[model samples]
Target chain A: MNNNTSIIVTSEKLNLQTCYDFVKDPSCGGIALFVGTVRNHSYQKEVTLLNFSSYSSMAVKEMTKIAEQAIASFDIYKIAIHHATGDLQIGDIPVIIAVSSAHRGAAFKACEYAIDTLKETVPIWKKEHFIDGQVWVNTHP
Target chain B: MKIKVLFFGIFTDIFGKTTIELEVPSPINVVELKAFIIKNNPKSTALHFAVALGETYADDNARIHEQQVVALIPPVSGG
Candidate 1:
């Protein structure tokens, strides 16, 4: 079942280069990586930080499904997914997705598609810590 | 039948706790379930949530399977 895919749930930070390296197999000539960091501002609010939480089991399952879908839909060889849980300070790497393909075009397109679709379909949620107040944000809309 | 419904984000903050179970005569369909939630918390009308039955997100026409866990994930504004 473990066919060169890395999907994990952890509060610890993510290593983008390591994720990229795993997908850097010789069979895949092109690689694309996307990182989602916690911005310090949301709709003009001074966001102090963010806290991310997810039902780990369900989240990992959903992410695995997403990776599988991407591989099926696009011509890609390798994929890696890492998401941070618990409290995350501003500018923290909350989500990371990297895809490798035979060509640059497919890699770029597939990588972008994965992240967008992941935001829509994944069960993860984030709580924004603003200077004055804090609020939880949902995935859709 | 009584089914526990989980709410997250704005829905959770308003409802308090992450889950709420309600007694209904039969299996609750997605539309009806949404109406029930909105009725219980009128202010939640502004919240747009996606219902999930376990790992699979429910569609608008989905019907809740008996005793299945349902989750209401409010519209997420996260990046």
Candidate 2:
């Protein structure tokens, strides 16, 4: 991917503005953003918090690969994918994807593809904490 | 041959450590390495995982070598 792709995997909070600024281009007409946040409930149970961990180096490479694929398949100008690590309370942002394109359709589609592929391929894991106990979701098997 | 293996998330809890160095036969492929891991760490025998070499996922046929970083990755949920 080109330098326009901003891929970040951090324990710090994810900023929508930083991602937006990176993808914003005067040449592009539309910018699409996807923000993933922690929810209070899941599978009919209450979720108190979430813990995210990853193979950091591999996660960045996978995110870059997704961005490259988005650029290759879509008419997008730039893309930014950022994910959070460590403990996150309910409503905390876990991920943000920003895509800019000359048209709205490509931007929207690329943003979706970026996030969808990330969930499947990235080397990050999420543990949902409940008052009773906790379990890992989206087990590979 | 000594290979460095990395554990994350649940694997860390199961292994009780972040990384470990293992000695194995020289010509062991990814498949054999996985079998060795499960046999040694019986708790992981039932869980499915992907073997990663460096920044990419290594297929079963991929040859593993000494001093290489290998990660045992469970299913991902990054969003």
Candidate 3:
């Protein structure tokens, strides 16, 4: 598939190098990448691990929209967004975003926009497992 | 019209299942469907959520049809 703008929702590990390489271009001077890893804690609770679930069809569709938006809103040449589903432990990479542009400013802006928009719009959910119990993140006030 | 409702995130916990079949009147919009779900599953009312008709994020006014895939999406936390 053309890597100019890729949206992936998978149960496999995310390779950062692959994302960086996908956005690499001879004409593009700058590339920005953002990696989201499962953290060890949340709100003072010790998180043991995380389990991610997604409405796969809608998640991919929404992610594609975010990438297209980033490309249109910024002077970016390419964008890649990958997200992992299923069980994940702390330090595991769950999401990766890469954007390339002719200049550093646009690349940075696009990269940030991609991730922020994904969190807000995508149909992916994370459940944080704690010692006492597990709770779905971002579902409460 | 009969539609398939797929629940995600905490909604699955609330409904005790991932997918459910609902029979509703024809010409029902998303707002009425949501109200029906909240009426039956009161626990779902606590979370902020949205509905997706097929693969598209739907507004409250979007119409739903028979056998259409409708998903209840709770606030997402994916990075």
Which residue pairs overlap in candidate 1's backbone?
A: A138-B75, A138-B76, A139-B76, A140-B76
The per-residue C-alpha lDDT of model 2 at residue A65 equals 95
Which runs of model 1 end up more than 4 angstroms from their true locations? A1-4, B42-45, B77-79
RMSD (Å) per prediction: 2.1, 1.4, 1.8
- Fraction of the real A/B interface contacts present in each candidate? 0.42, 0.80, 0.85
The TM-score obtained for chain B by all candidates, in the order given, is 0.80, 0.90, 0.87
Candidates in descending lDDT order: 2, 3, 1
| Model 3 agreement with the true structure over A1-141: per-residue lDDT tens digits | 344788889999988999888899999999999999989989999999999999888888889888988887999999999999999999999999999999999999998888888888888999999999999889422
- Candidate topping lDDT: 2
Write one digit per residue (lDDT tens) for candidate 2, span A68-135: 99999999999999999999999999999999999999999999999889989999999999999998
Please estimate how well model 3 matches the true structure, expressed as its whole-model Cα lDDT: 0.87
Tens-digit per-residue lDDT, A9-128, candidate 1: 688988899788889988878889999988878897888989887766667887888788888888888888888888888888998889999888888887888788778867778888
User: Which tens-of-lDDT digit does each residue in B1-79 have in candidate 1?
Assistant: 7888777667667877887677755766888888777777746357577777776777888878767788887764433
Q: Kindly list the per-residue Cα lDDT of model 2 for residues B1-79, writing each as its tens digit.
A: 9999998878887788999998988889999998888888746347578899977999999999888888999778877
lDDT, candidate 3, B1-79, per-residue tens: 8888888998889888999888887888989888777777746356467888767879899888888988888888888
